[model samples]
Target chain A: MNGTARHRILRGCRALALAASMLGAPALACTDAPRGTGDLGLIVERAAGRLQLVETTGLTALGAIDGLGDLSHASLVYSRDARYAFVFGRDGGLTKVDLLCRRIEARVLQAGNSIGGAISQDGRLVAVANYAPGGVKVFSSDTLELLADIPAEYEPGKRAKVVGLEDATDGRFVFSLFEAGEIWVADVREPRAPRITRLRNIGAQPYDALVTPDGRWYIAGLFGEDGLALLDLWEPEKGVRRILDGYGRGQEPLPVYKMPHLEGWAIAGRHAWLPAIGRHEVLVVDADTWQEVARIPVAGQPVFVMARPDGRQVWVNFALPHNDVVQVIDTHTRALVETLHPGKAVLHLEFTPRGEAVWISARDDDKVVVYDTATLAPRATLPADKPSGIFFTSRAGRIGL
Target chain B: MPARHLELRHLVEHDCGSCHGMTLAGGLGPPLTPSALEGKPLEYIEAMILRGRPGSAMPAWDAMLSEDDARWIARYLKAGTRK
Candidate 1:
């Protein structure tokens, strides 16, 4: 009970507190590490509501933007300079996002009943597929101004619907008619006024189209035809050639019943990965010859096919047959290398320019799942109020505002 | 009781088990047999049918089925065992 004894006890207690604080330091640091390194941004599309911006890495809810109603699809196209991202939606709503601020600077309503759209390679223009009117609307990327509304030609007695639109490397916009069994080619040299030069009959109900990086030709998945149609974009006058028929396995040639709806297609390098919506396998075709090179067995109905910029791996998203994973195929081996089980109903997938990360929009979970490109592990999940339409800007270093 | 059992059995064969499984053995979903339901109650099955398991392939049947309909499904699942 002396003064010296009391001082010694106080010193011992101080040292004990310091030791405890040191132990707690590591745990606090661990929390910070997970926040910065987890995931970047998630844009959630709520059905008949606004788009919610979420910071996945920090687990911070950024807030929402009103007026983007019932977004059925969305694609984020970053400028080549990586300065900004043009967020294109299915409802014909275009928003110019300042990637750094993650804020919508400009909003433009291009047309009505738009289902999907794509930005030009130069990032100067965006072409949208109008579903109800059966046409495409071209707009200026920088100003969010309407450029052209090209009318699509349909088959006799068949009402047409434009389901997918993609800008070919050759400065032309290729559009797929959902129920018309045709694809229209339009020249967009003058962004404001597109001149429709050719209308080619591909097959039964073309759903989606993709042009090879080389820009020599384009390929489309025929929903009712259950095959892929290869087009010679080089000669628009001669029209598209039905290079491959019954490209996906179906019951058309069999005595038994088969699910033959070929829904999604993508081209990486010289190979085209087609997700057979009716079957449990992905059909790989040689982009040059349009020949069925290989059929890779997958778990469910593969709905979306995307390839990394390096052309090394092709990712397929399953829609039906009920699988909660994205299957990655090695292009060189033509084999299933890895399966990314991120949650459920992965509808759309887009890869960053560097191929360092992948953004997956899962409809069932209403969240965008971000996976590390190298590890293929779920690094973060961006929760959307009602998620749909995922696109990343091709422009590097800038976040899609 | 026989009529109800037959109706429930018909529903399992046609509507429910077609996608889930043939013998409730789990094709697209987990098996719904008695062994698989071990430690789980009928309320769990009913809730799964109503709300569905989030982040899963199973979809909510709340709009399509009533509470009584879900209870019937759970009862049928409990009674039928693939032995």
Candidate 2:
């Protein structure tokens, strides 16, 4: 609807809300009638190529929508209004889905192979990081219309696979090249005319990268080396700095069955909790200095070391044989306080807006386990069909999700 | 088959299946169904598993799986059977 229509509707809602207040029908207050996007979330049914619309507060799945081709490695980004979700699939399917209506508004197969995607700071543009064509494609978030296409070419005839496409502050999108060992920042203020800034020789096989929640720093996790490369967006000319060098020096890293997700790294009070790739430890880095402060050992190779919204605890889930276990760490003390065995093959974990409860998806068990964070007890378990990623609409307001 | 091979099958169906699709019908990776593998050569299938398609998301299993192991997985995938 246009602005005038939206304004008229808002005026009507306010009048109704005022009338309800005068009648003393407290329950009918518009303020209490689901005003925020915090209630909605999405559960990815990987095998079925469907998305389950979930009511996060009630721990109930409303329903599932299908025809999303190749949802494996699918990631979702909500529009600024949180009314629509942009679902990026592995088969290059970019779908604009309506959350309220439970339907796909538009979809287009833009590439042969896509890893994941990101939305611009303003949420006007959505970009997909492609593996096959080795580039990033920018789309109009509202229409899913193609805007700009930037090929990640490292050599004369070689295009590098783009990964870790994240939206930093300003109108820029930052991403790393897995094969090129470089990080490039694309400024898409004009959409049609994008300015590219490339940082070379950052690190070997920078598997994935993440922008800090404040959108200040971009850190890339290296696969071929021990340490990670960091870049300060404010001072891009300082060059890339290598921190936490030789982290895996003495010991041989066990075979990595699945690449650990770097987006899972959490920034809590004073420190950032990062998963040590191929190791059963959570490396705590001093967020201010970007130095390794401590390492808290855990059950297995940590894939998702997510901090609660309150930043009081860091919840961790592992990879492979240890995926069944979920561990909670007290961020203040930096100690493992609780370990819960939710089910088999726990693929992902998501916390509610206030961090009162957490929802975890166990693929093999085919159920999403919800736990009360304070009580550390099971609150509810929702059955799903081979679920993986659980994304909340609350992520819409966050800077780097 | 040995117990180790059984474990390998579990890994393929669950671990690799994380992206390849639990039923092996394909997701991020191509479908490994019997009909999909009908015309593909046995050697090509095995090599694909062992070396992987480097430019794509598929990682080489050379560090983790042996040639014999890749051969077994290739045959099993060609058969398109899942537990």
Candidate 3:
């Protein structure tokens, strides 16, 4: 209890802190290796057709993998085990990557052009939505094996580009036909012989579609029509219904430099936050009623309106010239709470599983910025090359990712 | 090209670059390189810029872009200048 004893304790604490830093551990006393692939995620370097592997916990990049083909509009789905990544590239490249080995296990060009893809509920089948020679192709998630090919033919010998492909429960896949104005639900219960149920003339130019988290509803946003077409997967006999009719009826939408990404739909509680195409607003629609409840004006054309996992707040990003800013809205009040300038051309925003932190990808600045969700303060910044989408391993367990 | 030519050009290279590649090699949209635009007319390209092809991913830029801006983008795209 004297000066010499206190000095000794202080020196011992200092020595422990120094050793922890030297061992690349946190200041606290514990011995653990750096994160493994199970704790890792990916950031797409679009132009290079590569992915930067990163450890989600440390906010540090592990390595980069190349030869991914065209990744400009690429999207990925992780295996159920969280040990593999199924990357669907724009050039129709279906690649299965082993996270542990940090290398591609298998790769194949499945189509001429693809927009994105989905994994089945059981994580057994991988489905890709194609734009050219259009259709949806289902592959075995394990080896990228060609399981079944369902060409999206609008008419006999005439094909239509498919978009918004999402896998629902019970091994069912739903997607919209861009040119045919139809929505098809393919029951892949029998993988090779997919039983397709088509609802024709649902709307005009269905740009993109998404399924609710519960996998009950398939909503397609129409480009040629003002309203969105909704299909109740549970009751396909009910057919497609129209919701939010004449959304752009009286107003001329401002020039949209980039199409609003529908994958940005965020469901918080009972309301769904969706980006209003060509508008600087995020539409809050009742998930159950499928009706517009409120419209939250934002700083720019809202591109991605993602909700934190806890469903308390929704984060929105904008399309360029205003892509430098990001805004967070309190879901309870449906009000904009804060806006942060992440960097130049904020392309994508992703929140950690528990909503503890959010990662933002700024393409122009070539940096991935991570921020603490509660404090709204920057935590770490890692250099990247034109990063677009950030995907976490936690997605492996979720449906409709 | 006008006084804000660089800005507009960057817009094509960056903003339009969102769909079209940053280098204008094309992603969702077709490539805008000189070789690809060789047979296409400048007026057609400018029209496509000002009034986007509806029912597709392209959106009209006439609201935010001046005629000069559209023409500059058309010319720049046809010239195949990379960023």
Candidate 4:
């Protein structure tokens, strides 16, 4: 096609109203919207095994793509260019979705069960943290082709489930082994042949973990014990050190209805806001010293303790019985600033790239509510079905999301 | 009774599905599928609903669900009612 013809086609595509195919039909034929995906994102319809491609600026879903299997607790990472999204399904299916085309580009079942995944530093590779066979697998970001597999073998014939896999500054991937109380860093400078470094006895039952914004520290939250394991990627030779040691020192743990995920951890200003497992408090710790500064009691067991881009306010969601509520804390005052109920069973929340707005997903309500960060007022509500995780293409540029 | 029964079902699929997997095949928790519970007795499943396994992440649903609700869920899982 000539330049004018191409321009006409692009204009026509943008002129056409996008019909979000909720009935499993092809989303749109002429889907090249003649725009960038910077403000675009995806919402996981976990029960229906589909994803609704949405744009943050309009606060509306462009279309829906289906056929993803067992998306329970699903997550997605974007390519460096922010064009493609690598969706990691709970059924071990890694689907490469074309955000512009609104279709599945490539997909593969990498394991029996998978928790989540992260894109490599250069965005050339995508890594998945597996639960069934207990390992991490690397795939070509473009083709979804398996390149390497690193099993979390803590003992002979025994493998522990891998969690908290993330990308560091270089071509390295870091993750934690849940059952073995270990952390593994795989250097994928050479994709097929990874250089493995294992740090053992970090802590027991690391339910989930997260890498710091700068990819400096990898922290794993322990479910079997008190405290977390922190490994400095800059100084791996120093081994792992336990931080926030025994915050549960004299308290009895309330029943944790759901496992607290460290993915939502935040380091605002000089302190790190972390969720205390089986406890109703959000632990405020000095990032440099790793000492407990203040424990801010919340509405319930905190699930995600997230920070706004400005680091002025921190938002937290809860586990069952209190999952409907979201509380914000002012880092400076170290006090609860606001409390709001987005809807029933609020599963996940994501702030816009610059933190001007936040989108929260309430599974029971089947809608994602957008809130203005400044006023903390509801901006818009987009309907969905059993929505869980909201991932924006802005994460494409971040180190560890 | 029917409305509450449907709510209980939704609770099982959504609330319990948070950990048990929506299809009940399992994630961090064990599978609640019919095949995964073939040999397990119905009473055991119902009792587990009321009194969750101690020392594990599973919390007793007795606070939210009644004995009748637990029994209904046990049968519902064994039936493997497809969504």
What TM-score does chain A of each model score against the native chain A?
Answer: 0.75, 0.92, 0.90, 0.93
Count of clashes, each model: 13, 0, 0, 0
Those runs of model 1 whose alpha carbons end farther than 4 Å from true positions after fitting are: A1-42, A48-66, A153-159, A248-269, A321-323, A395-401, B1-83
Question: How large is the C-alpha RMSD of every model relative to the true structure?
Answer: 15.7, 6.8, 9.0, 3.6
Worst 10 residues of 4 chain A by lDDT: A12-21
Please provide, for model 2 over A313-346, each residue's C-alpha lDDT reduced to its tens digit, 9 standing for 90 to 100: 9999998668899999999988899999999989
Off by over 4 Å in 2: A1-36, B1-10, B18-71, B78-83
Recovery fraction of native interface contacts for candidate 4 = 0.65
lDDT of 2 at A309: 93
Maximum-TM-score candidate: 4
For candidate 3, what is the DockQ?
A: 0.40
Question: What's the lDDT for residue B27 in model 2?
Answer: 43
Q: In angstroms, what RMSD does candidate 4 have relative to the true structure? A: 3.6
- DockQ of every predicted complex: 0.03, 0.23, 0.40, 0.68
Residue A230 of candidate 1: its Cα lDDT? 69
lDDT of candidate 2 over B19-78, digit per residue (tens): 565566554456687888999999998898888775455666787789999999888888
Task: Give me candidate 2's interface root-mean-square deviation.
Answer: 5.1
In candidate 1, position A269 carries an lDDT of 77
Candidate 3 residue lDDT tens string, A1-401: 46685466456555666777799955633113322445678899887889988887878887788889877767898988787899988777899986654667799998877888999999899999987778999998987889899999989999888889998988899999988999999999999999999999898888888887777888898877688998988898899999999877788776667767787479899999998876788999998788899999999888888999988999999876688999999999887999999899898888877879999999879999998989899999999987889998888887678
On TM-score, the stronger of 1 and 4 is: 4
Cα lDDT tens digits for candidate 4, A1-401: 46786587566444442444555544455565467789999999998999998998888888898899888889999999898999999999999987876777799999998999999999899999998998999999988889999888889999888888988888999998877888889999999999999898898888888888888988888888899999999999899999988889898778787778788578898899999987899999999998999999999988888999889889999988899999988888998989999999998899999899999999999999999988999999999999999999989998888
**Chain B TM per candidate, please?**
0.81, 0.92, 0.90, 0.94
- Compare candidates 2 and 4 on TM-score and give the better one: 4
Worst 10 residues of 1 chain A by lDDT: A26-35
lDDT (CA) for every model shown? Answer: 0.61, 0.84, 0.83, 0.88
